[model samples]
Target: MKNFKIIVLAKQVPDTRNVGKDAMKEDGTVNRAVLPAIFNPEDLNALEQALRIKDKYPGSTVTLLTMGPPRAAEIIREGLYRGADNGYLLTDRAFAGSDTLATSYALSRAIMKIGDFDFILAGRQAIDGDTAQVGPQVAEKLGVPQVTYAEEIVDIKKNKAVVRRRLEKGVETVESVFPLLITVTGTAPACRPRNAKLIMKYKRATTISERQNVSEDYIFMYDDRPFLNLPEWNVGDIEAEPERLGLSGSPTKVKKVENVVFQAKEAKVLEADNQSIEWLMKELISNHTLG
Candidate 1:
């Protein structure tokens, strides 16, 4: 089989586990610093699946792609240490607070610019937004077949692929042509640990400011280290339609983000005695809390 060019979409999101009231901005945007930064869970799973494919296909390549601030480059280097051949950091101030539509537009154009892609893989949803639109939207923009909520590969060929997809009740098998986009679900395996040698070699790979932080050891480890830095792309990187590349390109807008505070509701006690229990059951049934 010929080598395949696979692109895996990854994301870095705020660590919600550490989120506090200060973690949100006045406009409801996440204060990424207040919350720790971490890779999107499902996206890491997607990377794992792509790496598995590379292991099976000799000479195949897995290229990780992500859209976020420049600091997002950390995970790009991390992906390389974990077996990805290359990565692209889509960074631009214009892309701030982008909904899924804007994100997909930027990604689709970048993928086209990267060229020679036989398959595109993404997590079914991003932890930060939880919107699964980007995967299918990229497919639509690229005019290729897509299989979403993919769980397993049942069959593979040079010109086509067949996969099992997750559904509410059960799974369904779907087939699509090459150059297809796949949105993977958490049902897939997790990302494996990085190779020891690659970690030693590429962990120093970094973007601009990252170099400023730990320059001598990490960024200047080798005479040729600078060559590996990812080329950060802005709105100018691709021939993207202006209206489709940023806030203007997005149709959806967030109205508000309420901070939900849980409070206990008044409850009536149910006695353990059968007669009282039966009466309580009847009352609960009448109130629709029980049947």
Candidate 2:
């Protein structure tokens, strides 16, 4: 069997599901500093799929790639505990205010710098953007086939990947040749928890920026163990064009944000009887609230 080189695209996004009144800033931008940052949930599913493939083939490697601020290195360290071989943190001031298009452009260029890979897996959509465009955009930028909403990767045979896709109405299976991108869906299996041994081994893994700010305790460890040094790439490192990065590259702009609060106008208390239940059903049908 051929040893596969799989790259999982993960993101450290604000936990939007627990958004509060202050989640958005006055200017309509997200208040990322106030929100709790976490590993994108669907991206965890993508990691699980990649790890499964690694288990099937000996010598296979699973590397994570995430684009965010210096703090985003947390996602890489999280992946290490979950069985990824290594990871790259793409960070720079130029990538600060990027939209989906610019984000994908930088990611595609970074992937190119990493050289050959059999698969690029990503989440179907990020909780922050929720646009579900980055993975397909990356595929288009790389000129490769893409499979979105993938629930599971069935198998790889003859350099082709069979993937099961989850749709609104039903499921569909599709196949794509090697060197393609796939975005996994939330319906896929949940990622395995961190291993105790892996945590002990990689607890001190730090990027160059992190290492510089930390105490002198791990200075000797960096020289003795190269694997403990996580890779951090800037715009210059990936050779991305300045014009196509950050706010300049982003075409989509938010106009305004409106907060809408819903309140119940009225309520009715009914006896727990068959007649009351029948009347409630009829009222709901008439109001088109149910059918």
Candidate 3:
């Protein structure tokens, strides 16, 4: 089997499931500090698919890519624990406050900088944005074929990948040529648990900035082992235009955000008989709730 080089795009997002009263700011933007940061759920599934490919093909490598704050380095370490070979963190204040378009543009430039990859895999969408546009946008930017909502990557051969995409009604199977991008859905297999040995080996992995802030005791250790240093790329590190990154690159802006709540005001108890059913149907039709 050809040794495949796969890149998995992951994200560190606020744990929206445990939202609190302070989850949103007065300006209608999310207050990320109040929420715990976690690996995006669907991205984990994408990592699993990449790991599976690595396991199937000897000498294959799985690398992760993520763009966020300095703390986002945690995403890379998490991927290391879950069998990824290595990862890069794209961090810089210049890349902050990016919408989906800007985010994808930065990611594409980073991808180009890394170069030479058989596949680029990512989640269908980030939980924070839920736009589901980055993966396709990256594919377009790179001029590669893309498959979204992928439940499984069935096979890869002859520079073509067979993928199974999950659909609302059923599942679809499609073939995409190499240098393609795939966005896995939550329906894909869950990521494997962290490996104890891998954790022990990579627990000390840190970026240049992170290392500077910490104790210097491990400086010699990491210097001796270059792989222990996770790559961190800033705006200047990639060939991205300044105007096409961060807020400037973003074409969309949030004018306002609203909170919506649904409540039931009334309920009617009815028998499980034909007459009750007919009456319920009539009421629904009359109210235009059913067409």
Candidate 4:
């Protein structure tokens, strides 16, 4: 099989499952400082898919591309530890408050800059915002075919790939040509653990912005080892239109946020008998909580 150039789109998302009181700001944006940042789960699945391709076809490269804050470069190192060849971090104030549409536009432009990739893979949705729209939107912007909810890449030929998809009701297997975009679902195989050797190899990898804050001694090492320098691109680096970035390009607006705290007014104790279960079901049906 011919080697493929694969780009995996990853994201560093706040662990929303552990959200605390400070998780959201007054402006309705996320307060990432208070929340723990994690690699998006499904994106790991996407990365695993890319790595599989690299494993099967020697000389194939898996490049990770993510758009977020400077701190988000952590995920790039995470990818490097998991077998990605290299990574690019897209960061700038212009990308702040970007909704899915703006994010897709920015990523599409970055993909164009990277050029000549055989495949683009991303998570089905980000946990922070479960819209699941960015991957397809990027494909639309790039004018390429897209396969969503991909469970596995069953096979790959010189110019095409066969993918198994996890659907709402069942699974589906389909084939698509190269230069395709795929959004991997959580149903896919979980990512392999970090390789100790790879971790040791790339532990010092830092983006340019991150390098600025480090010690002068490490700066020399970073300069000597080019791979240790992860690329950090800003809006200007991508040549994106200022008007079509960040909040200005986002059509969605958060008008309001309400916190509803439910309090238990009463409680009833019941047995596990069928009669009790039937009565509970009927009560739920009467209240429209079940039918």
Best by the lDDT measure: 2
Off by over 4 Å in 4: 20-31, 262-264, 269-291
Alpha-carbon runs more than 4 Å astray in model 2: 21-30, 263-291
Could you give the C-alpha RMSD of every candidate to the true structure, in order shown?
A: 3.4, 3.2, 3.7, 3.6
lDDT of 2 by residue, 38-118 (tens): 999999999999999999987999999999999899999999999999999999999988999999999999999998999
Question: What lDDT tens digits, residue by residue, belong to model 3 across residues 1-291?
Answer: 689999999999999887888887876667878898999999999999999999999799999999999999998999999999999999999998899899999999999999899999999998887989999999999999999999999998787899999999999999989899999999999999999999999999999989987676778888788879999999999978999998899999878777654786777789999999999999999999999
Whole-model Cα lDDT per candidate? 0.83, 0.94, 0.93, 0.93
- Which segments of model 1 are wrong by more than 4 Å? 17-31, 213-223, 261-264, 268-291
Cα-based TM-score, every candidate: 0.85, 0.90, 0.89, 0.89
Candidate 1 lDDT tens digits, 1-291 = 777889999899887766788877886567777777788888887888788788888899999999999889988987898899988888888888678888888998899889988889999987777888889998998998899998876667868888889987999998888888999899888889888988877776776556567646544453466547776788888777777767788798877877555798998776799999889778889999976
Writing each residue's lDDT as its tens digit, candidate 4 over 1-291 gives 589999999999989888777776776666778988999999999999999999999999999999999999999999999999999999999999888999999999999998889899999999989999999999999999999999999999767899999999999999999799999999899999999999999999999888888898778897688999999998888899978889999999887766544886777989999999999999999999986
Give lDDT: candidate 3, residue 181: 97
Q: How do all the candidates rank in terms of TM-score, highest first? A: 2, 4, 3, 1
- Candidate 2: clashing pairs of residues: none
